[model samples]
Target: MSEMVIETSNLTRRYGKKISVNNLNLHVPKGSIFGFLGPNGAGKTTTIRMLLGLIRPTSGQIRIFNQTLPKHRMQILRRTGSLVESPSYYGHLSGYENLDVIARLLKVPSKRIDEVLGIVRLTSAAKQSVKGYSLGMKQRLGIAAALLGNPDLLILDEPTNGLDPAGIHEIRALIKELPAQYGITVVVSSHLLGEIDQMATHVGIIERGHLLFQDAIEKLREQNSPKLLLQVDKPLEAKRLLQRAGLQVSMDGDILQMPNQGLAATEDVNRRLIQAGISVYRITEQSRSLEDIFLDFVDKEGSL
Candidate 1:
């Protein structure tokens, strides 16, 4: 197993009467873009706050870079960079100037500013006032600030929120390249599945204060199990016949659908249907969309 860059054990937090984050175990592997996914108010921000040591967990522990939080907070923070929600910046300051301000605060050398600006593709616009920059440019600038200290890990919470489609794509592409390009492990939080789908190598899905799923993106994709989609000449008859043979079946208009019980079962069904004079026009394996699987997890389960 790869070393975990971030791990939490039964991490919980509450505000007043509401339990914002229930017992949650989140694991983020080193050098992987781990997508912290959930809907709004699903404890993503609250969890992030705890991870950054901005807020204390009511109970449980957070381990980053293999050292416990609070105990090694300063040491861990030095190797980590983050942007939570919208980044704060002085509109009058140029992009370079804004980063220069952060660089000085971090005690980073001035030369490092140019490198991070280039990494975020904002070197050309480095001299322009931030107020004149588009939302995407400003976002990249924020990322550049986070990168100023040359962090080993980057945590971004909703970095793509309220952006145009083009802007979202820009951030997504940048994030996808960070792990290999810079050897940085990223733990990005988002309520948007499509954003996470395009960039992350692994995923942790949270809902109503509980972690419902955590695994490689491919594994989550696997959760959408393939089904045998059959376009039969007599759809109703095929469904009835299949069900009678102890096969659970469903119909989609003129199609018959059943669990894809591997090749042997599929062949047996085909043979049985053929023997019954039923015409099987087509046989295909279809899996549900990621959105469908995601919705199923969030709506029906406490964990997966």
Candidate 2:
């Protein structure tokens, strides 16, 4: 089993009467891409700030790489790299020069610049002026700067914020490759479920200053109760047949729906419907997407 790289116990942060983060207990496994998912104003940035010790938590604890925060801040930070929100770059300077300045500040070897540039696929545009780079290039450059520290853990807050579809795809691909290629544990935050669905190994969902869910991506999928939809000529009769077979069923227009019990159950439903003299036109199992699950969680929370 992998070690816990990030763990928070009742991590809370409040601003006067407004609570930004409410007892968020997050667990991130080592060598995994942990996607911090939430809607806007969900306190993702606030939690990240606390993790970096930029702001003190109201009351709670944070452990990174098995080291407690604030107390061992410098020791923890030395092994972590982060790119928060918009990246800062000297537009007047070339990409290479900008990285050179950062390297000098960190006192890292100058030769490491080229390696990072290649890692972010910015080596070809190393000499290009930052002012002329595209938004995607700038974001990649920000990631490159983060990599300059050669840290074991990388924290990125909305790394693909304002980019076209193609640009988002590029950044996602790069983030997915980091853990495998460099052995870095990544903690990336994003508001879009679809964005993280493609690359994240584990996901933590926060809403209204509260963490609604946290687990492996596959485990979340298992939590989704698959439903089978049946379109039949006799909806009422089909529903009756399914219910009589000890299956809970519902209906929507001409469609008969029931809990998906797997392939055998689905086949049994079809056969049973036919045996009852009901004509089954279509039997489709609808699986919930991550977006669907996210919205449901948020909506449910809002109601409570």
lDDT of 2 by residue, 196-266 (tens): 88999999999988999999999877767878889999899888777877889998888887888888878
Pairs that collide in candidate 1 are none
Model 1: weakest 10-residue lDDT segment is 295-304
For model 1, the superposed segments whose C-alpha errors exceed 4 Å read: 240-248, 251-254, 261-272, 281-285, 302-304
* Candidate 1 Cα deviation (angstroms), residue 102: 0.9
List the RMSD of every prediction in angstroms: 2.4, 1.2
Instruction: Evaluate residue 87 in candidate 1 and report its C-alpha lDDT on the 0 to 100 scale.
Output: 90
TM-score for each of the candidates: 0.92, 0.97
Candidate 2, run of 10 with poorest lDDT:
237-246
13: Cα error in model 2, Å? 0.7
User: Tens digits of per-residue lDDT for model 1 on 192-282?
Assistant: 8888898999999999999999999999998888899999888888888888999999887888888997999999999989999999899
What is the TM-score of candidate 1?
A: 0.92
Evaluated against the true structure, the overall lDDT of model 1 is 0.92
Q: What residue pairs clash in candidate 2, if any at all? A: none
